[model samples]
Target chain A: MTPGRKLLGHIALLVPPFGWLGIFYLGSLSVLLLSAFWQVDAMSGEIVRDWTWENFRILFSDTTYTVIARRTTGIALLVTVTDIILAWPLAWVIARKVGPRLKLTLLVLVALPLWSSMLARIYAWRLILGHDGVLNWGLRLVGLPDQNVAFTNIALWIVFSYLWLPFMLMPMVAALERIPASLLDAAGDQGATPWQVFRTVVFPLAIPGMAAGSVFTFAVTQGDYVAPMLVGGAGSEFIGNVVYSNVGVSGNVPFAAAFSLVLLAMVAAYMLLARRFGAFDAQ
Target chain B: MGPNVLMWNTKDITTAPTSWSIIYDKAYAGVITVPDNPIQIADAALYLSHTKPELGITDPYELTQPQMDAVVTLLKEQRALVKKYWALASDEVDLFKSGDAHVGAAWPYQANTLRAAGVPVQDIIPSEGATGWADSWMISTHAQHPNCAYLWINHVMTPKVQAQQALSFGETPANTKACAEMDALQPGSCKQYHADASPAYFSSIKFWKTPVRQCGNGQNTCLDYSAWQRAWQQVKQ
Candidate 1:
């Protein structure tokens, strides 16, 4: 083939993906940003062709929204930390300690929950966490007091950790696997304790993986409305729930867009910070 | 939609609560659940209309900024007592059945479902009255088959079909004639669903409608649905 013809064919292959990124990804993002600055007609609840900072002003000035932002951020941070801690040991066992067959089985078990619909899994948690749920039933069977945590922030915390644990685990396993076994043996030869070796050698190296996994765990929790709506109650309203009510019930697209931008900015800031910490080094 | 019933566990308390104030009581903290909808704001307003007459909220859906502020304050207090805000009727049903929610604002359907599951609960229309919706069939403005749309509307409006819908969906039929047909389908179903309700009974319920700037009081200054929605988010927050 001629050099020019070959080069043209290469560019042709790049078009579809670039088109998707540009049109679907960046394009929608641009629309969202622009709509945030648009105005809403109070009477008919229509988006007017006018530019205003009213939506953002309400978002910032409102104390209730400030509380919401804190709640969403607080939960997201809690979930990220919980997932990292939970995933660390399991990732270690599967990556280093297990036989090949067992590793495969363990990995499958970690991913099995993801195959089921998230909605179904969350609902199952209700069956387990509700007042007369499995947990309470088991407690009663053991002659323990019945506990109620079904529709509170505690439920949100438990469900979020369960849902995002796998996301944390995969990256964690990848990071742990990348660690050379020689380092551990060398540490032992130098008379370093196992705790010392893990703390110094294993933990620092796993940072990148934990960081990578946290981007998913943290960001998804920050933007999640479904779990909160389904499992969350009075004090458990998230930023996404407000955004949804604005768009779905009120038909206030501009306001919803504005609130979404706040979420985007928060998640974007976290990702950028994670990137700065070299979370993507493994990738 | 049926009236937003105030339901409580029969075993938890022997006496049925008469006021909406019980949902806001601190005694029920972390066990109260209500619908997680923008329309829930109206319920809060309806509660205030009786208690705080100075706010002058004649229609639960219609409110001035000051009235909204009062309602918001009341709801924010109630927020702390809530265990969760449920979206689906089944969620509320499960909550009550599981004994997670001892007292909550729910619909008749949940009360029925819970009772069917052998959970002892009683639902009452609080002294402040209640809010509800009368779902209707509407033809799309831009329907490609306008003739078919009108035919469908007419078909559903007929007494026999209306009775069928009333029985199946558990909503009162608009056609008064359908009430008799409903009884024919299932004896006492008409009275059970309140399809043959007295005018006074009908007036007690504040059926839901999209709040507009131009309200029933003929004032252009009333806060619209968007405002209620925006305020609802803050109240929940």
Candidate 2:
């Protein structure tokens, strides 16, 4: 095709999506940003159209910024690390070593939960992790005693890690499978042990996938409300809970908008820092 | 503008053209929006005035003590029949619109829309009473149109103006004097939009108060939402 025709075709493909994005996402964000600057008469539900930094001032004061920032970062980091650790072996086994049929079966197993509704999957975790749930039931069958372990921070992390495991494994497996078997064989032939071959070749080749997976897990889990809401009990109050409560129950839209903007900025900064450190470089 | 006046409508369920037993029996099983808003309480009080039922409620003013007790009993009995407890106006609207609920409490806007769409949604004001919220028009300290705002408030609060609004919004008129003028607007509209609608029932109806902690200045200071949430969870359990 001619360049002009090709360009026209591309434009035709892009225009509808661009139009929708402009009107819905971009326009709405712009309005939300504007709302952050305006004052509200809470009782009257009236909007006073004046530019002010009072909302941002509230965002910065009273330890709000410090608390959410620290919480989001810590939760994101924890989810990313834990998901990767759990996914590494599963991905490695399914990538190059397993037979094609078994590999596909295992892949189906990994992908199964992705087809379920996010809310249903999270609630399923609740059933599995509740005080009198299957996990306790199983423990009791095995002569283990029961306790109030489900309503804790650890349970939240486990459920979050489970929820994001597929994201990590799918990427890592694709990255690992792309490496030729000959390369690993060569490393082993050069007197490198099995562990050394993996360290020198397999791990190095999967860095990009690791980076992408980590980003996906961290970004998603940091803002996820369902898992925390279902499993975290009172202690599961993350940035998502704060944002939701501020907007809905509190009816403080401007403050919620400001906090959301701050969260976006922090996530962007963290991703930039990760990329700058060559976290995505596949050796 | 003076505080935007929130408006609502309710049916006269107490002395509807039908029998009280049939209505209540049908309502409990039929699907109705339980009043979750302040205005709904007032609207319900008004509806109760006209009807004399053999069962629990006949007076609206006695609603809080009696109503809460009734709800606890009803819930214990018919908890399974209630699909869900809706917390927002849109949720109740969805129930009616989607046919998840047939007879229930609803906001005026939703009812109007449903009626326009040819849905037979009777705005029930229980014979016991009609319950509703009463909002005042208060200008902000920083209002730009302080004079206009006050003008708007007084103008809307007048008998004729209040009746006109009551007819349109389906709310009980705030001005008691507005009752006479509303008769010209519609046959039953005035009675439906009475400020003290279903007075016999409403005289006993209790108003919804914001939850408060055991403190002197009860401006949402006492019981923080977190505490309320914990209580809600315990109540649910």
Candidate 3:
């Protein structure tokens, strides 16, 4: 085969994927971003093509979006931190300590829930957290009082953490598995304790993986409205919920589009910060 | 259609509430739930229309800036009493069944469903009356089958069909004769839902309408739906 033929083969493979991304992903996004600058007829509920900054003005001046945005970002940050603490040990055990067969079993266990619909899983959490739910049933059996945490921000946090744990675990497992066994052996030969070897060597190598996992946990939670809808209480409204009501309930496409741009900017800013921590390199 | 109502767990609440004021009472704080909807602002406005006549709020759907301010103030205070703002009728059902909410602003559909599930819930139109909605059917100007549309509307309004429709949706029919059909379908349903409601009973319900800047009194003083939507956001906050 000639070098030019090889280059032609590469182009053939690249064109299809590039075309898909260009037309579907970037195309729709551009349309959404364009709608942000438009306005709607309040009475008729029709889209007015004339460009205006009124939507953005209301978004900024209203203070409601600011509060919702902060609530969403804060919750996303907490969910990320919770997943990191939860997934780190499990990922390390699967990658370093377990046999290959057990490793596969553990990985399957971590990922088993993802095969089911996300909606189903969130609804299942409701059954567990409801007033007469499994949690209270267990408490009663153990001679303890029933507790009410259902439909609260605390319930939203638990559900978000559970939903994104697999995303965090899978990436950290890959990063941990990639660490060479020779590095550990070398550190031991130098008379380093097991704890010291782990602290200095294993931890540093895993930072990129943690950053990669945090990207999924944080960004996904930031844009999620379903969990908040199913479990969140009064005053637990997310930015996504506000955007949703604008689109689905209020039929204010322009305002929904404008608010979505805020979400995009937030996620894009997060990506840049994650990139600085080497999230891209791990992936 | 039935009015928006106050549904309470008869077991938990012991005493039946006679007014919308129970929702704002600090005594029931953390045991109440309401719709997570902007339209709920109308429920507040309806409450104030009678209690604070000085605000001059005649229609829940039509409001000036100051009327909205008063309604939102009431909503903000009621927020403290709410355990959660339910997004769906099913959500309220689950809340009542699990003892998460003792009383809430709900629809008749929720009460019927909860009672069927043995939740011991009852609903009512409080002393200030309640907000409701009417469904209208319109024929398209350029429709290919306009005659078929008319036939469909006529069939839907028939006494027997209206009774069936009312039974299915837990709502009342506008046709006066449908009350007799309701009794034929189920002996006590006509009385149960007040299908044969008097003129005075009908007058109390403030049906929903599009909130426009143009007021009924030939003024542009009333705020639009967009303003209501924004005010609702602030109320929840």
Q: Which stretches of candidate 3 lie over 4 Å from their true place?
A: A1-12, B140-142
Write the residue-wise lDDT of candidate 2 on A1-283 in tens digits: 8999999999999999999999999999898888879866544546778889987785676463565567667877998999889998899899978999999999999999999998887767656765457787899999988644453567778888888899999888988888998998899889999889878888888877888788788887777765655555323456776667556665667767777777777778768866764456643
Q: Could you give the fnat of all candidates in order? A: 0.95, 0.00, 0.72
For each candidate, what's the DockQ?
A: 0.80, 0.03, 0.75
| Candidate 3 residue A225 C-alpha distance from true site, Å | 1.0
Q: List clashing residue pairs in candidate 1.
A: A233-B84, A233-B85
How displaced is residue B86 in candidate 3, in Å? 2.1
**Candidate 1 has what TM-score?**
0.95
lDDT of 2 by residue, B74-113 (tens): 3333323333334555555545544445555444555666
Write down the worst ten-residue block by lDDT for model 1 chain A. A40-49
lDDT of 3 by residue, A110-154 (tens): 889999999999999999998889999999999999888888889
By summed lDDT, the worst window of 10 consecutive residues in model 3 chain A runs over A274-283
Worst 10 residues of 2 chain B by lDDT: B1-10
